[model samples]
Target: MSPFDQHQPAAKPLTVLIVAYLFPPLAGGGIPRVQKLVKYLNRMGVHTIVLTVEPPPGMVEDPTLLNDIPAHTPISRVPLPRWMNAFLGLWRRRSESESGKQDGTHSVDAKLHETAQEHGQARSLNMKQGQTDQRNTVFRKGPQKLKQSVQKIVGHALNWLRARIFVPDDEVVWVRGAVRAGMRVIERYPVDLIFSSSGPLSNHLVARSLKRKTHLPWVADFRDPWTENMHRTSIRWRLALEKRMEKSVFEEADAITTVTESFAQDFKRLYPARDVHVIYNGFDPEDFMELEGSPPNAPLTFAYTGILYGKRHPRYFFQALKRLIDDGMIRPDDVRLEVAGVLDYPGRSENRDALIALGLETVVRDHGFLPHREALALLKTSHVLVVFGDQEATAGRYIPGKLFEYMAIGRPILGLLKPGEASRIIEQFALGVHADPSDVDEIEEALRHIVTLYRSGALLKDIAHCSSKDRLSANERLCANERLSADERFTSEACLALEDRLRRFRRDVQAEAFYALFQSVVGAKQR
Candidate 1:
C-alpha cells in the first residue's frame, strides 16, 4: 500500500496548539511570527488554538493582528499575576547566573562617550588623510579600567535579578498552563499535536511537559537560537542547563524548525543527532495589495521597524546620517530616520539619551511600538527600509523578519550590518546596499549613494525591475512554509508514538525495580 493509503481518511481537521509568551496582544517580533503562523495555519486546513498571556498594563494589543485569527479559532488567555512575573524574573536571572551564563552587565556610559570622541576624531582623519594633527588629535584617552570592572560586576548582578528571579519563566508558565489546558481539551476532544515557537526559552519546557503527559508529538519552532543568540552571553552552568533543556526538547520533539538556515546549522551543531529544518518568514501578498500611497513628509524618510538590540544599534545609523548631514553629503531637509518598535529594557533610556546627545533628537523620531500593519504602511511610504544585522554573530544566522517584508515593499534597503547572511540576501535580490555598522564612513558612503540616486531620480528606474523580481514566488513561499509544516507533521506523529511507548516502558521498569527492592527489604526484616 502507498504511504497515503496506509493512513485512515482525515477525521476532524488537524489541531495545532500554539504556546507562546508574546502573542497577538503583546507587541514584539515574536508576535508577528505567531500571528502569521496562526493565520496561515487556518488557511492550510489546520485549526489553531492559541495559548498566551493577557497584555500587561501599558502594553497595547494590536486589533489588526487579532482580527486575522479565524473566528472559529479558540484562544485561551491566562492572565499572569504581576507579582508572579516579578518573582519569575528574579528567579530566571539568578538561574542564569547560577548556570554560569552572563545575566547582566553595567551600562558603559563612559565608554560610550569615549567611543564617540574617538569616532569623531576618526572622521576628521578620514576627511584629511595627510593631516597628522587631526589623526593624532582623534586618538584620545580610553575609559578607566576600574570603572569598567565595577560596571561589569553591577550589570551582571542586575541582569541576574531581571532575567531570573523577577521574570518568571514565561515559557514555563505558559507551557504548564497549556499542557494542563491542552490535556483537558484533548480528553474531551481529540487533537493531533502541540506546536510552539520561542525566544523566551520557557516554551520548550511547556512543550516538553505536555509531550510527557499526552504522548502527542511536538514541533518546536525557533525564531532565534537559544544559546547562540548574540544578544545573550552564555555562562557555562546556564549553557549546560540550556543545552540539556534544548537537547531534551530536540530529542523529544517530532521536528525542530527555525527561521534562518544559519540558525538551523547552529542548532544542528548543538543537537547533531536531531533533525532541524529552516523556514524563511514570508509575507501575505494580499495584505500589501491595497497599498496606500506614501504620505507627504518633509525629509526623505528612512524607517526601521523592529527591536533594536546591542549588535543592531540605532547609534551607528544615526551617527552615520549625522556625519553625512554635517559634511553636506545630504541636507537636513533631505533626510530623516524613524525608528518604530520597543527598545528592550536596560539600554533603552541610555540609547535615547545618546541619540539626543548626538544632536539627532529632531532628525530621528521614535514612534515606539506601532502595530505591525501600521509599520508596514509606514514602510510603503518611505524611500528606504533600514535593515540591521547583529554585529556579534555571523550575518545570516538570524535574518530579521522585517527584511522579507521590506523586500515585498519594493523600497531601496539601506542595510546597517556586517558582511553576513543578510548582506548576501540583499545582494542576491539586488534589493539594496549594505555597510559595516561600526564604520561611519562606509555608512556615509551607502547613504550618499542612495541620496545621489534619489536626487537624480534614477533609483526607481534602476531598482524597479529588480524590486519586481524580489517579490516572493508562490513556489518559493510554499517551499519555505513546507519546511516548518513538514517538520511539524513529522514531529507531532513521532512524539505521539514515542510518548506512548516511553511512558509504559518507564512504568514497567519502575515497577520491576520497586518489586526487587521490596523483596530485599522483606528478607532483611524476616532475618
Candidate 2:
C-alpha cells in the first residue's frame, strides 16, 4: 500500500474540484490558505483540480506560491471577457494619470525646496524661498483643489454604480464563465466532490449552481463571512440581496468550514442543522525551516506583512511609537517598524501619508508588497511580528491569516487587535502581548513592556532556551523557573501548550481535517 493510502477513505483516493477565484500567484486575500490546502492534500493522496480566474493585468503576483502545488494537479485559469479586461485597463490608466499629476507637483516642489535649503538663503528666501513658496502654493492650491473635487465626484458615482450593479461582489462578472468552466472540469474528471472558497463570495455562487447540476457532495468554505464582512456594502438593498445569497449557500452546501471558531459558531447559530467546521488557516512548517535564527542583541525590530486597508491601519501603533519617541523611552534609530504589502485602500487615506504626518517617516521602513517568501524572510529577521485588524463590530468573527504566519515564524507577535480570536490566541499561547487597537495608552504600555523585556535580556534568553529544547517539554522547566510569579508560571505552561496546539494548526494537519470532512460528506452521499 502507498504510504498516503492510510489517509484515504478507501483503496481509491478521493478527487475534489477546488473552486477558488483567488489562488496561487495572487499575493494576498486568503489565497495562501487555499494554496496550502491544495499542497498538503495532494501529499496525502487527494487529487485536486483547481478552477481559478486568470489574474488580471497589474494584479500583484507571487509566482513563488505556485511552487508548492504538485505538478500533476490540473489547473484551469479562465480569462476574463475581453471587454471587461479593456474596461479594467482603462480604469487603471485613468488612476495612474491622476496619481502622476499629483506626484509631479510634489516632485517639483521638493526639488525647489532642496535648492533653496542647500543655498542656505531661507530668511533671505523671504526674497528667494518666498518666490518658490508662492509658486508651490499656486501649483497645489489652484489645480489640486479642482482635481480633488473632480475625483471625489467621480468616486461617488463609481461607488453608487458598484453598489447597485455588483449584486454580491465585483467578481460577479466572472461567475457565468467560471460555472461554465467548472462544468467542463466536472465532465473531464471523475470528480467526487466540489469544494469552493470565497471572499468574493462569487465562488460559492458558482459552486451552488454546480451542486444543483451535478448533485455532488459540496463543501463551501468561508475564509471570511459574506454579509457580515466589515467591508460589505452598507446599502440596505445590496445587503438584503447578499444575505439571500448567503442563505442559499448555507442551506445548500453539504458541509461548511470557516477559519475561526467564532465564525463557525455564528454560522451554526444561524443554520442550526448545517455541518459547520472550523478548519483554520495555517502555516507550512517547511517554509521556515531554511530561515536563519534572529540576530542576538540587534536593534529591536517589529515587522508586519499583508495588506492594510479599510479600518486596518496602524494608527494606534503609530500613536504609541510617537509617545515612546517623545518620552525618550526609545530612540528612532534603536527600534524599527518594518511594513510590507499594500498601504493604500485605493481612493482612501494613504498609510504612508499618515506616517509622514506623524513624523514617523524616517522611523518606519516601508517595503511595499514583497513576494510571499521574501515577506516571510523579512519577517524572520524581526524580534517581533506585528498583526493588525479592524476593531469594528465584525472583528471577533474575523482572524487575519497573518496571525498563523507569525506564529509559524516563531516570533512573539505584537497584536494590535480588538478582544477577539487573534487577541485570545496571543494571550492563551503566551505568543505575545496584545492591546486594544483603539487604545493608544494600552498600546504604549505594550510597547514599553516589550522594550523592557528586550533591554533586560530576558526576551532573548527565553527564545534561546525555547530553541534548545523540545518545546513540548519546556513547560515543566518553565513552571519551575523561580523568576516567574504564580501567574507567570501558568503563562509559561500555556506557552508550551501553544506548540501542542500549533501541531493541530500545521498545514498537513489541517489538510487531514479537510480530508476527514471530505470523507464524511462523500460517504453520506454514497449511502
Candidate 3:
C-alpha cells in the first residue's frame, strides 16, 4: 500500500474529477486553494483528476503551482476556444469605443471616427504601464457638459451590453469543452464524484451537464458566492439569472461546499435540503520556507498582495496614511504601502487617482499583479500585511484568504475593512487592528495602532518565534474573522480553540475535511 493510503481509513481510494476552471499553469488567488486541496486530498488517499482549461490570455503564467499538486495527479487541459477570446477582445473594443464620449464638441461624426480608431487599436492590445489611463484620458479630455451627457448615454449602453451578453461571465465558452474533458476523465478513471469549483461558475454548469449524463454525485464548490458578491454590479435582473443558475447547480449537486461558513450558511438558507459544508481556502505551508532574513535599509512596509478593485480598493488605507502624515503619527518616509496587484481587472490602476489626490504618490507603490510566489515573498519583507475589504452588505460574509496568508506570515496585520470578520479576526488573534474602509478618523486610529505595533516589533518577534507551527495555535484566537462568528458552527471560542488546538489551517488539513466529505458521498468502507 502507498504511504498516503495509510493516512485514510478508506478500504479503497475514492477517485474524483475536480472540474476547476482555474488551476495550475494559470495563476490567480482562486488557483492555489483548489490546487492545494487536490494535493492534500490525493495524499489522503483520494484519487484526484483535475480538469481545467488552457491558460487564458492575460492570465499570469506561473508553472510552480503545479509542483504542489500530487505528482501523479492527472490534469486534463481543455483548450479555450479562440473565438471566445476573440469575442472578449471585442468586449474590450466595445468599451474603448463607447466608454467616454464626454465632450459634446467631439461631435457624433468625430465620435464615430474615434470609435473606429479605438476598435482598431483594441484588436491586439499589449499590457504596458499607463496604457489604460492613456486610453481613458483621451475621451475624458472633452467638454464638461457634453462630456457628462455623452458619458451617461455611453456608460448605460455599455453596461447593458455587458449585462445582456456576458450572462454569468466570459468563461461561458469553457463549459462545453470542460464537460467533454470531464466525460473523458470519467471514462479513464473510476471517478465516483464530480467536483466542480467555480468563479467562472461555468465549472458547475459543466458539472451540471455531466451529472445529468452520468448520474454521478456532483459536489459544487463556490469559492466566492455568485449573486451575494458586493463587488459585482448589483443588478436585480443579472442576479435573478445568476441565482437561477446557482439554484440549478444546487439542485444537481449532491453536496455543496464553500470557502467560509458564512457562505455555507447562505447556501443552506437558499437550499435547505442541500448538504452545504464549509471547506475553507487555506495556505500550503511548504510554499513558505525560511522567509528572507530582515534586511538593512528596509522601511516599515505595509504590503497588500491580491486583486484590488471595487469595494476592496485601498483608498481608505491611503487616506488613513495621509491623515497620519498630517498628524505626525508616522513619518511619510517611514511608511511604504506596496500593493502587489493591479487596482482593477483590466490592469487599470483606478486607485491611482485616490493615491494622487491624497498626495501619497510617493509613499504608495502599485506593483501590478506579481506572480503568486513573488507576491508572498514581497509580503514577507513588510512590517505588516494589509488587508482591505469594505462593509458593503454582501462583502461582510467571509474572511479573505489573505488573512490566512498573513497569519502564516506571522506579521502584525492592519485591516481597512468594515466591522466584519476581517476586523474581528484582527482583534481576536492580536493579528492587527481594523478601520472602516471609508472613514478617515477610524482609519487614522487604526493606522496609529499599527504604526505603534511596527515600532514595538512584537509581531516580528512573534513570527520569528512561530518557527514550526503552520499558523497561529491555541493561545492565538484561531485568527478567523468576525464573519466566522455568524456561522452557527463557529459560535463559541471552545469550538474555535478545538479547531485550531492541534494544528492550523494548512491545505492538508483543509483537504482532509474535504476528503471526509468525499468519502461520505461515495459510502466507501473504512479500513
Candidate 4:
C-alpha cells in the first residue's frame, strides 16, 4: 500500500533479538531509527523481539511512535531500579514532612515553593498577572542561581563519581535486568540473530554477554562512536577500559554496522579482519505521506526540530539573526524562527535563556517537544530548516538522524555544520547552505545570503511543493534543479538526485541489507 511496500518475494523469516536502550514511548532522535528498523525488518520477513528500558527521567514519550511498530512484535522493557534512581536522578519529595529538603546544595521546585510561601510572598500561579510578574522577578532566578552555583561547584566531582560509577553510562545499571529478560525470550524461541544498537554503550554491553553465552551470530550497531564521542566526559582510565571492551565486541561481532561511512571505516581499521557495514541514518518516508502539504502565502520560517543543548546549541544563529536585523539585511517580523524540542542542559534552561538574552523571544517560537506527527507537520510547512552540530574532532563522522527527515520534506535547509559528512551530503544534494557553527560572523554572512534568496522567492521554487498524495510522484520535481545554472543554487534537478540517494538509506532497504547480513553470518540461507 506504500511506495516502498510492493510486490516482492519476502526473505525467509528469522527471529531477531534486538537489544536497544532507547525505543518508542521514550522520545529522542534514536527512538525513531530503531522503531523504523523494526517496522521494515518485519516487512522484509524478519520477526523481531525488542528489549529496551522503561521510560527514564527527562524524556518526552510519544506513544504515537508505537503506532509505527508492527503488530505482534514483542517488546520487553526493564525498569530502572529504585536505588539507581535515588543515586543518579535529582531528589523527589515523599511528603510535606520533608519540606525544604536539600539534595546536596540544590533544592527541588517543591522546596522552593514552600520557601516562597513561608516568606508571605504571593505565589505566581495563584496571583494576578502583575503580581505573578512581581513574584517571577523576585524569586525565579535566585533559587535557580543557587542551584546552578551548587551544580557548578560539584560538576567535576560528579563527573569523577560518574567515571567511578556509570563506567559505560548511567544506563549500565539496566543491563543486567535487560539480559535476564532477553534470556527468557532466547529460551522460549530460537533467536537466529542478535542485534544491538547504541549511543549509550550499555546496550552493546548487554548484547555482548548474551552473544557470549548463547553463541548466536550477533550484529553490533553503533549509532555513534564510543571512545571517540564528543557528547560526554571521557575519563582516561574509563576510556582505556572501554576501548578494551570495544575491542572485545568488535572482535566477536560477526557483522558491525554504523550510521556514518567514516565511522565504519574507522572501525574497519580498528578490526581489519571483521566486516563493517555503512547504514546511513535516514527518514521513514511513509510517516509524511498522510500529512497535508504546505499551503501558499506562508511566512518565511526556519525550524530546528530536535534537542539542542550544551555544545550543540545554536547561539550563533541567534547572534546572526540579531545582526541581520540591525544591518537591515532581514526583517524581524517577516521571518520567524521555530524550535520544536527540549533545550535544557543539566540544572538550567540554557537554550531558553539564550533566546530571551538576545531579545528574539517575540520572533522565535519555542514549541517545546511536540509529538512526532505534529513536529513533522510543522517541519513540512517551513521555508528553511536548521541542522546544527558542535565543533569536535569526531564531528565530521556525526551525521544527525534528523537531516534526512529535513531532506524528505523537500524544503531548503540551512545547516550549521563543519565540512563533514552531513555538510558534504547537503552540498552534494544542493539541499541548502552551510556555515561553521562556531563562527558567528560566518553564520551571519550565510544568514544574509539565504534571506536574500528568500526575499527573491528562489528557495521555495526548488522544493517540490505538492499535495500529500502527490509526494511520491513529485520526486520528478527535484529533477529540474539539476539542469539549472550555477546561479540557481538549489535547482529541481539536484533535489531529485538527493531524493534518489535518500532511497538507499530508507528503513526497508537498510533493514533488508541487515537481514541479509544476519542470514549470511548465521549461514541460515544455505541451511
User: Which of the numbered candidates is closest to the native, going by highest lDDT?
Assistant: 2
lDDT of 3 by residue, 115-201 (tens): 212222222124232223333222222336665456446545655655556667656777888888888888888888888887767
Clashing pairs in 3: 9-527, 102-147, 421-481, 421-482, 421-483
lDDT of 2 by residue, 248-318 (tens): 99999999999899988888878898868888887777776655646436568788886564467787788
TM-score between model 4 and native: 0.83
- Candidate 4 — worst ten consecutive residues by lDDT sum? 101-110
| lDDT score of residue 432 within candidate 1 | 80
| Prediction-by-prediction clash tally | 37, 2, 5, 8
Ranking by lDDT: 2, 4, 3, 1
Q: Scored by CA lDDT, what does every candidate get?
A: 0.57, 0.69, 0.64, 0.68
Tens digits of per-residue lDDT for model 1, 1-527: 32222322245556667777677655555566667667755665556787666654433455667777788888777766667555434432222222222342211110011111222212321322122342222222233666545545655665555554322233344455666766676676555677777756676677778778887767788877766665453445555666677668788887777777788888888789876766556555555655565523346778887656555666777777778788877775566666665332321244565656666545555455555666777787678899876666355466766776776676778887777677877775566899887788898889889888777775554322211334533222222211123345424444344333222112122222222322332234336
Name the lDDT of candidate 4: 0.68
The alpha-carbon RMSD values of the candidates against the true structure, listed in the order shown, are 14.8, 9.4, 9.0, 7.4
lDDT of 2: 0.69
Local accuracy of candidate 4 as per-residue lDDT tens digits, 326-370: 887766666776666634433555555666777665555545566
Q: What TM-score does candidate 3 reach? A: 0.79
Which model is ahead, 1 or 3, in terms of TM-score? 3
